[model samples]
Target: MFSKSCNYAIKATIFIAQQSLQENKVSFVDIAKEIDSPTAFTAKILQILVKAGIIESVKGVNGGFYIPKRKIKKTFLVQIVDAIDGDSVFQGCGLGLSHCSEKHPCPVHDKFKSIRNQLAYMLKTTNLEELALGIKSGETFLKTL
Candidate 1:
């Protein structure tokens, strides 16, 4: 349901959040390798993330990318989606019709509305901290095991 770049962005953010929790930073190269994305594509995604203030970048010899520890708890999935994919996923038609609104509903409009609402709710309520912790504790896998 998300773009490929958005998927990598979420993974990169969670990884960065985990490192931030440990008072560490990650280089873009490491982020790409860990998330199984190409370095160039991950670079573009990370640039968007940094521009959106979801992560920070530094340029010293020891510097890299990291999120503020306190901010991760408040960084909801919606924000990341918005930053990378915009709010269209939350507001677009189910069947990809440009005119699929309430007045001119698509065949699956009603059903998809419910699913979209559920997705929106999940994104709004879910924060990066819990996701980062899940990986940190070995309770979840960001990639296939």
Candidate 2:
């Protein structure tokens, strides 16, 4: 699983990518509305994304947030996760133990490690373009309707 901020970041990125595909930039207000995230929190998440090179922002009247059309396909989900949550999810102990590791494994360490690997693969392979397209097609969504 991911932090609430990271989840919102992913939704916001996908929304931005969808708009980018249509050659439009999106305001943080619109992104927050689409993802059903609080404005201040969304702004924080956007800042992190921008700093991570996962999204871009512009200033002035015609300015807003957008992912480059070309980068959409190349922007994997893992990048957003890393930007917001870092690599903690990948190496973190399943049981939330402070000193859990291979030799001093948690009760579910082996199984949890496998699950983490699969999740990492999923994140690494999943890209914003595909997710955005799914939303644009109305087959998927970032928030409850």
Task: Tell how far residue 77 is off in model 1, in angstroms.
Answer: 0.6
lDDT of 1 by residue, 11-91 (tens): 999999988999999999999999999999999999999999999999889999999988999999999999999998888
Worst 10 residues of 1 by lDDT: 136-145
lDDT of each: 0.93, 0.94
Model 2 TM-score relative to the real fold? 0.97
Candidate 2 residue runs with Cα over 4 Å from true position: none
What value does the lDDT take at residue 87 in candidate 1? 90
C-alpha positional error of residue 5 in candidate 2 after TM-score superposition, expressed in Å: 0.9
Off-target runs (Cα >4 Å) in candidate 1 are: none
Colliding residue pairs in candidate 2: none
Number of backbone-clashing residue pairs for each candidate, in the order shown: 0, 0
For candidate 2, write residues 1-145 as lDDT tens digits: 8999999998899999999999999999999999899999999999999999999999989999998899999999999999999998998789999999999998999999999999999999999999999998999988886
- Candidates' RMSD to native: 0.9, 0.8
